[model samples]
Target: MSEEEFRDFDEELSEGDPEEGEGEVEVVEQELTKELAGECLSLLSRTGNGLSHAYVRLDLKNRKLTDIAAIQSFVHVRYVDVSGNYLEDISPLGELPQLLTLHADNNRLATINLKELQYLQVASFAQNKLTTTEGLSQPMLDRLNLSSNQITELSGLTETQLPCLTSLDLHGNKLTSTIGIHLPSLQKLYLASNTLTKLEGLEGLRQLTTLHVRENQITTLDGFAPSMEGLQYLNLRGNAVEVLSELTKLQCLPFLRGLVLAECPLCELDEYRVEVLILLRGLERLDKDEYTEDERADAEELSKQRAEEEAPENETVEHT
Candidate 1:
């Protein structure tokens, strides 16, 4: 063969080879260029809603999204929902600094690094394969739903750090004990369907309004302290609380309104009922039932006034 023809054939063979580093570099460059074009398109598509307002919702349910590198350009995202995806790691989402809400339930995420999400408010990691709860550093977070996971310990949550958290749902886990943890602002705490045998860590939560301690092996209420003065509702139903004697200790909570002792082994309501009534003089409800005549009358009067104000003028005239 001629020398020129031999050189052309060699060139063709090199271009056809798959293991060439030059070809790999060209492919990577194409991918990066396409990604940049997509980012430009995304930016152009966004309306002038606000400066700190960028929402990206990705529902890759049951899809094989192995790498989320495309989301690197969405640094201004405020909300992201990648629930039900096959994501094993969520490190890609760390690039978004302005994220507020994240819904990543029913995935294979074992751990999350949420240190960059400083503005995140609501986070749901339910039904994931998480064994340990860590790396959540958002100070303004209000709601957290981590139910149906394999979390065995509640040691990561301390009162001094998570002061802004109001609601926490840790149901269907393996938490056996809670010690040295205080949730001061927690209003509703759901620890049902867990392995907790005692309520020890809840003594210092003065602002706890609703506590669902049902379906546990709690036999006594001795862990409760009088400092829980703002407790309004208590649900010890489905427990082994045979005697209702320690309930008098809760009398200091003058705002205690509702008490759920159903399914307990209590056969008599003799003096305990009267004691509770006398102690919590402001008790207006119990087990989803209204209070006595006076409280019900007051509530009805307020409801009637609100109804009159909300009624349409034509409806009022027709009624008159």
Candidate 2:
């Protein structure tokens, strides 16, 4: 609970026993913003021996904390969840070099700098008001979720190479292009619900497996880099791509297994499923349905029929 909520409870207790209530109220008030770290410091204060160097975890979520600068004292804290609060400045956390995972989403934080926390792995700053990823980098960072923010460019990501980074979630942002994203080892990329009209700047992510570009404004499959041959799962569910011929361009993705085009306008075509299965021969699933042997046979037969029809036209052009 917040300090305001505790004040109301303290008032009620004070009404019962004036002398006893005054002491209890003072203690609670002091503990409310104890050491300027909210409930985390309150718990540390009760430890009697002071904050231990061995303490590794601290959870002070939804405590309506305005200040957490006291976190510098807990130098050994590895995991911290300070989500859903009124925090604005988190520069104090830069001193905690042992921090690994930090969940500070859904807060009023305008900026966060964790460049010093080299051991930090998972850093989720989603649903905040961050306009840029200026000072956000770590050597061992594996997963980063900065979705639902105002990030427009990918230059922040291009500035450094996160060698160990794999999963990157940039969904629900205002990105119109992805020109310089250079994470080489990245596997899963979530760019769903953005304003991207073309798929570019992915040549560096040669190890990418899962790509989610659903709910974007992509119109064609021509811009995808050849490095996307390693892609196994692709989601272009709510795009503007209107033709089945687009699947032919993705023939290079031989490892593609699952594809989501449920709400796409191209899914309404008469030969949509069969044409997709034929073009992307390695597809094991399409639009939430598993590709069966019957479907494969039908697609193969259709492919032969189209090939036969095109043969006569080619022969006539050759003669001319």
Count the clashes in each prediction. Answer: 0, 0
* Model 2, TM vs. native: 0.82
Tens digits of per-residue lDDT for model 2, 1-320: 12221111100000111222256322121112434443353222222235443546778777766677667787767788887666666777788887788898776566776555778889887777777766666778899987877788776564264668888888887889877678888888888888999888787788888888888899888766677888878888889988888878787787778888878889899878898887888888787678789999999999899999999999999999
Model 1: how large is the Cα RMSD against the reference? 21.2
Candidate lDDT values, in order: 0.62, 0.73
Residue-by-residue lDDT tens digits, candidate 1, 1-320: 12221111100001211222344322121122324323433222242355543334433443334456666676656566666555567776777776677887766677876564567788888877677766665677888888777888876566555668888877777778766456788877777767777778687787776677666777777667777777777776667776656666666776676776666665256543443444445665544454567655555565577678878876979999
Best by TM-score: 2
Output the worst ten-in-a-row residue range by lDDT, candidate 2. Answer: 5-14
lDDT of 1: 0.62
Model 2 clash pairs are: none
